[model samples]
Target: MPPFVLRSPEVLLSVPTPADIDRIAVVCTDPAIAEWTTVPSPYTRADAETFVTGMVVDGWARETMFTWAVRAPGRPDGTVLGMMAIGLIPGGPGDAHAGEIGFWTAPDARGRGLTTAAGRLAADWALDPSGLALERLQWRGFEGNWASRRVAWKLGFRYEGLLRRHGVRNGTVCDDWIASLLPEDPREASEPWPQEAPTS
Candidate 1:
């Protein structure tokens, strides 16, 4: 699928460009991002360049994954607030009508509803009949990533359960917190939010 823009009254979701490489590199260097995501530890400028110039370009051209940068409406592309992705899970004929949703927020963008807003826009597009027409959307994160869970929660994703050692984070095995949303699911959360364990 060709890259396109998804917009809301407050946020705009558009393609990430080479102009975003430096910002992406810096945001990805944060320990929290590396700890919770599969992004390389000690993420580099070269990695960022490859992400925008290589991976992103190929994903769109191949129609395997669609990615977007979340920014405030009318803002320059470099002032990205976050990134979002919708990846088609190839499974043959019907493709199971399934896709996975993923996102990461820039450090300064945390604690606001920006990620949720952007994700909602992208997800709605993916699920629309005129869009990807996906039947199910899966969301996964490291087991302890409450921040990510919170966003998924707000997007109406229902907690599915933890997957034992089902994911990898920077080469380390990790448990995955999984969730799913169907086209029939409510626009608001389908169930009560799960409580997070004490950090201390």
Candidate 2:
């Protein structure tokens, strides 16, 4: 476990500093991430640098995205385990009260439920009045990414529908699994919605 600082329940998210970029980069560049996500294949240090400097900074400065650094459970700055992003939230003047959540973990950190935990935390914060005006939290993932879909389902996101040819990954059009959690739903529950998978 790694040390970590929680974002105010109001903010619902936190940003990773440049110091955490290297470890994050290692995970982002892993074959699993590239294979499942829109992240560029052969992800490099340059891409990682952009995420820490240009992208994260610019998104924050412009209020386009809300992000968090997922640290190892007990170590605040031990290493960047992965990251989470709340995309397209209704924060700007003309924005709507909707948001999409996204996250990825290091290959070494996979299957540990960090993502599911982070999702619950972020969603709980996002739906609070002090945070974003999230009437709904949406999750969209490539159809074949069972791990990602599992995370969303574990967080009580109901599968709403599928988007055919909804996203392009490496020049290939892929279907997407679309899901959403309503503000009235109970988030942060140890148990999932009845329709969610039954864990042994």
Clashes of each: 0, 7
Please give each candidate's TM-score.
0.96, 0.83
Top-scoring candidate (TM-score): 1
Candidate 1 C-alpha lDDT tens digits along 34-135? 888888889999999999999999999998889999898875464978899999888823675889999999989888788999989988988889998999
How does model 2 score by TM-score?
0.83
Question: What is the per-residue lDDT of model 2 for residues 1-200, given as tens digits with 9 covering 90 to 100?
Answer: 12224643222235687887677777887778898788877888888888888877776677656777876555455566668877765563336678888888877767777777777777876677877667878999887777888788778888788899998877799888898888887563334443544556
| Candidate with best lDDT | 1
RMSD score of candidate 2 (Å): 5.4
Q: Which residue runs of candidate 2 sit more than 4 Å off their true CA positions?
A: 1-14, 89-94, 188-200
